[model samples]
Target chain A: MDTTQRTEQQRSADRRRRELLEAADRVVLRDGPQASMNAIAAEAGITKPILYRHFGDKGGLYAALAKRHTDALLASLRAALDAPAERRERVEATLDTYLAAIEARPQVYRFLMHPSDGAPGEQGFDVGKHSAPVLRRMGEELAQVIEERLDLGPGTQQLARVWGHGLVGMMHAAGDWWLGERPCSRAELVRSLADLLWGRLAAAGDKVGGPGF
Target chain B: MDTTQRTEQQRSADRRRRELLEAADRVVLRDGPQASMNAIAAEAGITKPILYRHFGDKGGLYAALAKRHTDALLASLRAALDAPAERRERVEATLDTYLAAIEARPQVYRFLMHPSDGAPGEQGFDVGKHSAPVLRRMGEELAQVIEERLDLGPGTQQLARVWGHGLVGMMHAAGDWWLGERPCSRAELVRSLADLLWGRLAAAGDKVGGPGF
Candidate 1:
């Protein structure tokens, strides 16, 4: 009952949580979005009750997994941004990371986008709920860059937020669509998206008579 | 049977089809995306077999509703486009119709996006599968408009298809996001979205150098 014992117990619990999450990811990837709780528990080599004890339920588990995946994606994007490049190149790099993440783990992405066990009466699939942290980070990053560099106006932050959502949403839909129909190569799709986004952004920047894109 | 009797039976069957689809819509709205065959049949004052008879299975039923809803939306957009005005005005009106339809029946949209009983191990949602007719129409309309009016190159058709998908996907995600987070009024949201769409669109058109907004 001493502090060291308590700390040891907490560490063990955290390790168990990580193990369960890793099992859940494998099950989800293998079974697609409709992977069952029993399957997840089985994959973890644990009972369903133990799985539920660690994570409240399927939704909680999905949310935790979503947070994990979103953070990883954001980290990739950050790394992409870190590479010294032009503004447009940086945006492309970020998008490339986003799309690649979705491509790499589409089942997890779809499960996050629309969990099969979503509450019965909700009208709309709350994409933001599943990935609010990433959305917030994307908005902050874009808004910060626009304000610090572009100087679009007092409304730059709001505009950047709107644009950020638009871009994120675009990628979300485009990624899903591309997963279904490979009308173009991944590189081509990425380039087309980058062109559309960077073209508009640069044009808007020019209209404001601000920094060169 | 006599011709008149056959015609009467056909009319009655059509009526039943419409009734069942309406019931399905109501069930989906009330129960969100987890709407079951039993609930749909109960809503229609029929049995599950009868419900399945009309649409085969849940996926078939979803596909039927998707076609119905997508058709209705395309009709509204066509009407919006028919309004005599500038090109920009027409585009805004069309987008307004699209967003309004989604807002009006977000449950149908969500159900279409992700049926609770999606087939096991399905990789992609295949949104265009459910709405291919609309996508085709939108692409043809935009490409023709660009071709006839703008005199863009032969590649304009492909560009229009890509842009059509991009625009549709953007609205899809943005509409879902707005459903969850009403950061702005519908009018303001529509206007802002139109500005982004039309702004990028007009900029693209100008580079082609054919038409003036």
Candidate 2:
């Protein structure tokens, strides 16, 4: 285990991890999220031992996949938020981005959030380990961005965080139902969703919420 | 085949259906949503064929369960909304009702929304059949109430439906996450949630949503 050998091994491990994840996503996309570990290992052309070594178990693989999806969503959201847009337009864009993301990969999202609880040994997976952090981190990021976006005062971070979680939750709920029966057009849905977030922000009127005016 | 026997048989049949659902729910509660049909049949002290006869199959059982859960939620929401409280209080109460419902039976709600997609022949269940009408009816009810509560115009019905679905969805997403960690007080979560909707309605200022207030 010399330095050269160790370094080479590390690189090899990284490549293998990346390759496995890519293969997993491919199977998910093709066969939907319920595609089994057997299928994923087969897709990667790797054996079960190696796959388990990387992810530990089915839950581990799910968390890694969820983290990957969450990271991608965060990056996209940050990019959209960073774009030069006014308050209203930015709210619309941010929410619309989320709606599209959920609509796009519902199978993956559903698996991550709502894994089959009745399966033997599968019931023990802690959903909070994966989902709660996504919301908390997303809320944290959104709070900072929103404070800057709205030019709110220092104490508004908490309020912004509240709005962030609230809005994210709102989008998810609406998106889940909407995915089934698209009652409104994309534009309409985006605008309607934004109304509550932007409307509340505007109503705050340079205040951070206390005994209101 | 006599009318007296048939009517007597109908009552007994209805009772059996109710008992089976109750048994299934108990199994779900005890064993998680992934609780098998075998488990449910065992719980009811009946055989699988009889269970199949009552409901078409596993998919049918799931739909029936979802419908039961959805209907229960709808009834609770309607009662809260129908309460003779002030507008703002009613909003708070309604949102709280939703939060409580999700918190109370998270497993059932999760099962309805996120059933195990991996189960054999379980993939054929129609999720939309159970979830859509609930939102649609809620939207209609909310639209009427918003018109009365916020004094918005008739056109605001669409806006109201958007908010209804939006509010329902928001509560669900937040409730799902909140069930895990409970970051805030129930009162706080409900209040903040209501704030977003109320603020938007207030901002409308007796308009039907076009532009140029």
Candidate 3:
């Protein structure tokens, strides 16, 4: 085939793939982590075999779907992190950005981060294998940003990487718990997390009649 | 049966359960997350049926094994947190205790937290169902400690809970990556994490010719 024809065909294929991913996203939003292959195929107006041919398997579909969300979320986070603001402001903004994304589409967040195993329609989807890639990627991305922006003297790279993973884990675990039990407003959650990062935990006074934390 | 006989039977049954769990721990230690029922039974010098009879299923056995390790680890953490020292020391100790446990027996930690599914002999095991309980319990335990000791004014309980989960996540994610890569010494990892918690991230200066993180 000519280069022009091949390019046109590639564009069409990419468009078709995007359309399929959108349908899959809708089903995942409706069904959380137990999104079924059969349902996704139906949503895409294709047979199961065709869906499998496109994505390889349920795990592959989930990975692709997760990557789409993770990438978009990371982009938003990057903007927040890179905003022309003070470090504290940027940190709070970044935290708020993540909390907002998870709050807005908790189903997508849950599917990407905590796909429950043994749920109906979860066959061929190994939760353990897929659960950490998003978090890991976010950690690595944050580490890169930290390394590039901050001057940490010696071992800056190592410290940035540790803090990167550590901070991501903190945000994720707190967000997961908060989503399940909305004990406070999103703003409050953001402030509290930023405060913790700001050394408030060390700054807080000990309660009366007890040793300090 | 008489009360005396019943009591003796109960004690014997409990002893058998302990024995079986010990065997399972050995197998899991050797085999990581994919430790199988067959291997566990062989380690116990008992048949698979007896293993099943004792624990109900592989998941049950895993839960028991996880609880044993988690309980021990938590006790050590509690000691560290409650140590009669300055808050920073306690934090470092707690961090060190957790890091040491995971580092010493990465296989057990992996089995408890990141059990891979879809491996051979993993038919009924569900990684997602069981993965979070340990982290959840640890978060709750830490939350209690923070709430009891720290005076954060109004909304302290909620803040403590968030920080509890967040800190655990930070420690966990950092420890997981560190364990895998050993980018730095355990002492270095603990110090960096403590630094992050103590507002070092906010205190950090921007690298020359770049916006700060």
Per DockQ, the best of the predicted structures is 3
lDDT of each: 0.62, 0.66, 0.85
Please give the distance, in angstroms, between residue A155's alpha carbon in candidate 1 and its true position after superposition.
2.1
What digit string (tens of lDDT, one per residue) describes model 3 on residues A1-73?
5999999989998898899999998987886656677888898898788787778877788788888888999
DockQ of 1: 0.13
- Candidate 2 Cα misplacement greater than 4 A, ranges: A46-49, A100-137, A144-158, A198-213, B103-157, B200-213
Candidate with top TM-score is 3
What shift in Å separates residue A2 of candidate 1 from its native position after superposition?
4.4
Candidate ordering by TM-score (highest first): 3, 1, 2
Provide per-model DockQ scores: 0.13, 0.17, 0.60
Instruction: Rank candidates by lDDT, best first.
Output: 3, 2, 1
Residue pairs whose backbone atoms clash in candidate 1: none
TM-scores, all candidates, are 0.77, 0.76, 0.88
Error of 2 at B148 (Å): 8.1
User: Residue A179 deviation, candidate 3, in Å?
Assistant: 1.1
